[model samples]
Target chain A: MTFVFRNNTIERFFSDGEYAFSGYDDYGAVPEAERYIWWYQVPVKYNQEQLITEVESYLRRLQWAVSQVGQAPFLILSLELLYDAGVVRGDRRLVNAIDAFNQGAWQLAAEHTNVSVVDFGAFLKQYPAAEWVDWKFYFLSQMIVSPRLAGAFGQWLQTQERALAFRRKKCLVLDLDNTLWGGVLGEDGIAGIRIDGDYPGKAFRYWQEAIRELAHAGVILALCSKNNEADVKELFAAREMPLKWEDFACMRINWSDKAANIRSIAEDLNIGLDSMVFVDDNPAERELIRQQLPMVAVPEWPAMPYLLPAFYDRLVKDYFAVYALTDEDLKKTEQYRQNAGRAQAQAAFTDMDDFLRSLEMELTISPATEVTLPRIAQMTQKTNQFNLTTHRYTVDDIQRMLDHGARIWTLAVKDRFGDNGITGLIIVTDCGAVDTMLLSCRVLGKGIEHEFLKYVLGQLKASGLEEVHALYIPTEKNRQVQDFYDKNGFLCTREEQGRKAYRLSLADWDEKRNTIYKIV
Target chain B: MEQKVLMVLRRVFKDATIDETCSQSNCKAWDSMNHLNLVVELEMEFGISLEPEEIARMVDYAAVVEIVKTKI
Candidate 1:
């Protein structure tokens, strides 16, 4: 049972039975409930200071009510002053106070793990301010949100609840030719392709930026196009588009079937086909994916390029709206990029050694200095999937480690594709124990992790360390690195509950750094 | 016009038993809230806004139809 702490008569907006409302302006002891919703809309008042005081008090009431509800998914609807009479009177204090209340609600949500702030402004912005509160209805009933919008509010609330549940899609598989930009790469040629000049090109540019924003928010972007791989690469290198080659988690730029390619992408990312969204301008290609890979989402492409903005909005709302992003979510792009590289390596390379060689990989491993402290610390905090010990450190922590004679090495990897900045790190204690070892997921699928470890071990061996101790501590996200030390020829000194303690002797073990990467 | 009124009444009250003879006195669901809902639905259906006095007099089904006809 969900109980709503509302200041106005909003029972008409929320559906019956599933929800019950408190008395008007009641902020007393919240009864025991499965869920709670705090939706206090801006009251209609003429006096500015009185309105400000009332609006500001709502935040305090909300804080008290939230304290009563013990971790039961408390949702706060942001305060949006619909009819601000202060605008005409040249008094902006009430408007600012309402904004302050909304900000306080957001801060409360940030502090409380169970609290989430819903953007009520997003719903209210749809209708005109004049239509927000009908005076006749307000006089008859204390309905702050117009009774006319009850049906829409209910639908919007449903979408908000679903967003809170976090069922958003993981990957967006895109077709490049006419989808990302205007015209075809093969037919239009590099110079002829429209991406930045006129109406259609401008529209595509706007759409590309939106997709790039989505990528930054941790949605994996994969390319599934029927075009020459060389042509696509050349365009990414030459064209100054918002989306770069590295932004895409994977790209299938070939004449092979798109459905098969999408399947390969899903497999490469270790995600289900249902979690992937496929976008293509070609109806025939969309139909192919729909029929063959029925689990993949295939949103209908707009006929006109100008209609893309609306289409993109609908796409995000349906597939990618989430209440909040976690650290795992923030690192998804780099992780997927690494996975995509591995997937591409599998398709492009017949031999693993040959693929590593083709990358012309260069690894720059060096001791940490003052300038590299922050980056190293950030890598430890953010890098989870491939971390051996899963130890998070701050800049000050690394500084203290350096003071105590702990050796730290930072790895920067650059290949034929592009430069991956400071992608790996290893911290060793003074007593020859591998304190923390982590590689950013962007550089993972390549045998770079193995090479990085071998090179670091070789350095420690050269420094006259007879043997070094290491650990593989288990975490919810670091399952891939559970057997990392075992695979690298470290003797398992102790093992329990997916965690392993290892000791590698430099005298017995041969640390052979692969010749594929030129390490300095 | 009578059919449209009956349709609005049936939908607003959520009762299929609503007919031309149905009035506020006879119907159990015809409460103050439903009365407002009926007014809103009728205004939307016929594209005509009813005055406050006209809405107060629309207590019975015949009075509702009579009031709506004058507005149209």
Candidate 2:
């Protein structure tokens, strides 16, 4: 179950079953839950001293909660000062206090691994102040947000939950012509395009800037336009505009069906079509893509060019909301590019194994200590695709395991190009049971996780462990890891409730690590 | 006009089966929280601003339609 610590009337906006409490000023026990949400809005009162004291107390309360609930993910929504303080005296102090509070939340998140800070200010920017607060509702209840926005807010909150679940789309497939700019690139020459100068052009410029920020936030931007590649390329070269051609990782600029172009873009980016959002101004193109590829999200474009900001908000809220960024997510584009490079380099070698060996991969395995415990626990929580058993563990639970004589090993892989830090972990109980074994999806295709496991098995065998038992628990997000134990040579002993248990004789196990990965 | 107000309320409250008997005091879901939601929905649906007194007195389904009708 999820719990929310709120200062406003957001209880009605979220899922019905979730629990919420009043603001930090209210003294109450933090309820028992798997996750916690900090949804406190910036107070509307302009009392500078009172606001500062309240803000400080809020931080203290959050700190107390964090100390109490160790290792459980605490999702924090950033504070946004929504009200216009023009009517009140000493407004700057209130603004400063709110700013300090937001910065503190970010700092706290950075310090604590389980804390995730989401920007609520970005969501608040969607509506004007007049529409944001309704006097009638404010008088009825202390609810700061107007009721009229409940539908949009509910949809936005759902997107945020999806984002928290780590289910954001991988690529954004964009359309050119009036979609990318104010005018068509083919009809209006590179200089004649409305991407930099006046009213509509400035709006498009703002839109491009927003898209650029999305790209910076690790969303892979791609282009799918029915125009000459050279023309689009030239427009990007013209220094008048803020966005460039090279800003996009992939492009499908031929006069082909948008569905086919989208498929090609996904293939080029090495992501599924379901992980793509197609944006275009033309209804026909959007409808065609929608019919052909139902998995790919196609948001309706606003009829007026001036509504691009709103359109951008809809796009981000619906598709690109993320709880937090992982190290793998930050280097996703680079990793995809590396995979392409590896594919090209593979043809030069005589055999597949020879090519793999030539990569000079190194696997570093050690028992998870104080430094690597967070990554280990995160793997147990988030590693779905390559997990042997989908066992979610909190930091406190992992600490308890260590206290109970469980051996947990975390593995880090490094190649010539880069280091994939603490990508996999295995927890083994004293009774020869593998409690959890999982690897991050980024380093899966490289065969590093297998070698890491084999090295651990060799160590266990040397320590006189004759047999090991393992389990594969099934979850909606972890279907990809169902046959993981079988692939690793463990014999299935039982299957129940879609979960499979496996046993392996370590004495008879193959102790050979892959020649590709050098174990040190 | 009353029918239009009821239609708007039903749609906004997301209860197609709602009737005149439904009100804030009687319906469990139509408390202060949903009252705020109902006000927002009513305002947006009818394109009118309701005063605080009218919003406070909109306790039942009939009263909801009456207050909304006065505003329109």
Best model number under lDDT: 1
| Candidate 1 residue spans exceeding 4 A from truth | A1-6, A9-36, A56-74, A82-143, A146-152, A164-253, A264-276, A303-306, A320-351, A366-377, A392-407, A429-431, A458-467, A506-510, B1-72
Q: What are the per-model DockQ values?
A: 0.24, 0.49
lDDT of 1 by residue, A168-261 (tens): 8999999998899999889889987778978999999999999998987889999999999998999989888989998988778899999899
Candidate 1: Cα lDDT at A262? 90
lDDT for each residue of candidate 2 in A1-520, tens digit (9 for 90 to 100): 7877776666556645656564545547777788888877767766556666776677777777777667888888877766755456665766676788778888888788788787777777887767777666666787777666766776876676667666578888899888878888777788778887787888889999999888877888888999988878877887466667767777788888888888867765668988999999999999999999999999998888889999898788778975467665677765665554555456589887887777777888898899887777777887877787778898899999999989999888877646767888989998889888888876776667678778878878888999999998887777877887788898999999988989999877875666677777
lDDT of model number 2: 0.78
Kindly list the per-residue Cα lDDT of model 2 for residues B1-72, writing each as its tens digit.
677767866765678887878876666667666667677667777799888878778888778777777777
